[model samples]
Target: MTQATAADAATFAVAVPALGPDVRCHVLQPGRPPLFIEPAGERLLDRAQFRQWSRTVRPALDALILEHGGIVLRGFPTAGTEDFADFIEQFPAFDGGYAGGRAPRETISGRVMEATRLSASVRLAVHSEMAYRRDYPRRIAFFSRKTAEVGGETLITDVRHLAERMDPELAGRLATLGSRTAINFGPRRDADDASYAHMDERGWNQSFHTEDPAEVNRLCAERGLEPVWHEDGSLTVLNALEPFVVHPQTGRKLYRSILHMLPQVENPEQDLERRKRQKYPTGATLGNGERLTDAERAHIDQLCDQTTYSWPWRDGDVMVLDNLQVWHGRNPYQGTRDVQVALLD
Candidate 1:
């Protein structure tokens, strides 16, 4: 077979023989709408095959994305028991794993691990993982190795949708309030006896720590978060701001902003201070300024809840999402569950 040229590569299309009507592909940008790539039939690409394909097609895949924004990869092999690390490495943007900083007890580190374990209980409320960090991931991917015995479900919310639906007054308030977050990594409580008492604990604190407090202050003042000390001892700082980031290639606003810390709603200051006085370990502060109030807190929660969506687990299903645009969470489940994860810069 002859090698394909740049022009040929630009127009090259991979024949996906195993996608259904329910699976849709979107260009992930504005201007031109998404182009549908219909598969000839349902087909599955195993790990070895996918790896081999990546070796020769990565460059072409990159070019395709440059021209089309994104692609919905379907027909990948899965078994409740297949090794996924190889497949994850083939797709850098869809690697499932954890990046550790604050939490030491349960630092998740690879695609296979993230794929098989239950990170949090399904009944737990929905939240974006690692929202407290300043440089959080911009994309997320999950592969279901097994379905839950009972009520496990995955929910996803398009934050952009929320932004569009937001009341102008509420949006203005949140934009002005910015956000703050305090993370704890120590045991919830010590064991009953001395055996566990006085253990060397670990944790971290993340707030708007910057060289210019005035600038931070100016950004959050209108949000009503003026560095108030909580009865529990922690202090609350807020930053309200927005970036009009335009996708260089697409020339469209990304509209990916949120008050993930939910400072005004959770009021972690008091609890955080109490934990500090208790001598628990902690580290780091990441913020851009902004605070919240009771009213603002309620509004934000309502908005997030309304925008949330879920991806139910199947024994061998892989789900990929635009982290910047989609918010995800887990549903309650029964019995043991396993998951693996990885991240790409």
Candidate 2:
């Protein structure tokens, strides 16, 4: 899709009078994703004013995210985690919480987390947050505390666009067969240990935030995951997920798979050797027990890239997204890049 017209992007401003005459809104690039909103001048809103503004625009903000997939609030006076948490508190928290989340992140405060602890060299794949889970957040917000010197743009893509671009045959197969995702959690290895071979690796105890196996199993059951125990105290959870879904509010069909986030096979034929050689701790297979070929994956990646949009992070820049409609990822970067995130239902 082409970039939306200025009038299309200004709908939020028309609806939310509290945006003030000094604030400006526009699209980022070839597309209108993450509609950019910032102060038109040097005048910045204080914490109190920012909170009040957020409260007044909450209804419009929801509509904007649903329409644009994401939005970035730049030039806001956000100093630290407190300011970020305060801004997020204005929105309803996801009551289900992030108990079974797979990201290797640290919780900085209430409903706030350090985005990820992965190496800066690792480029994250674009996928909806927690799409594999039975109970996933409907919305997610991100905050950038420090911008990377070289790269590290938070990538986003509209799922509707991606679904539209997908091959009809593959899309139909996915819709009919769905997909099965599995995550393996071995005993926690030292972060610096060379044996740390898997992405986002964590012990089952750490993953479920509990010491008891029964508690972990209970959590898995509640989250629609089937847990399997290994002899070495490792745990593997399996879940079957629909690759396509209808948006609850919009009634639009969305491509909701996380195939890009997992290890993929290069060969079209699924064999025992390929399965054994899979290196990632997490992987997915077609619901019919077939693996997706790397060629097919490349096509999907291209579709995502064709619609993907990103912007360099600035200090205190906040991005809010409709998780069901948008897919998010990261680009490999150099230097220190600090980003925080919050999830909401």
**TM-score for all predictions?**
0.56, 0.87
Off by over 4 Å in 1: 1-47, 52-75, 80-82, 93-124, 187-291
Off by over 4 Å in 2: 1-18, 41-44, 188-197, 264-281
lDDT for 320 in candidate 1 is: 46
What is candidate 1's local distance difference test score?
Answer: 0.42
Top lDDT hit: 2
List lDDT for all candidates, in order: 0.42, 0.75
Residue 251 shift from truth in candidate 2, angstroms: 1.1
For every model shown, the clashing-pair count is 45, 0
- In the range 97-142, model 2's lDDT, one tens digit per residue, is 7765766665789899878766676677788888877788899999
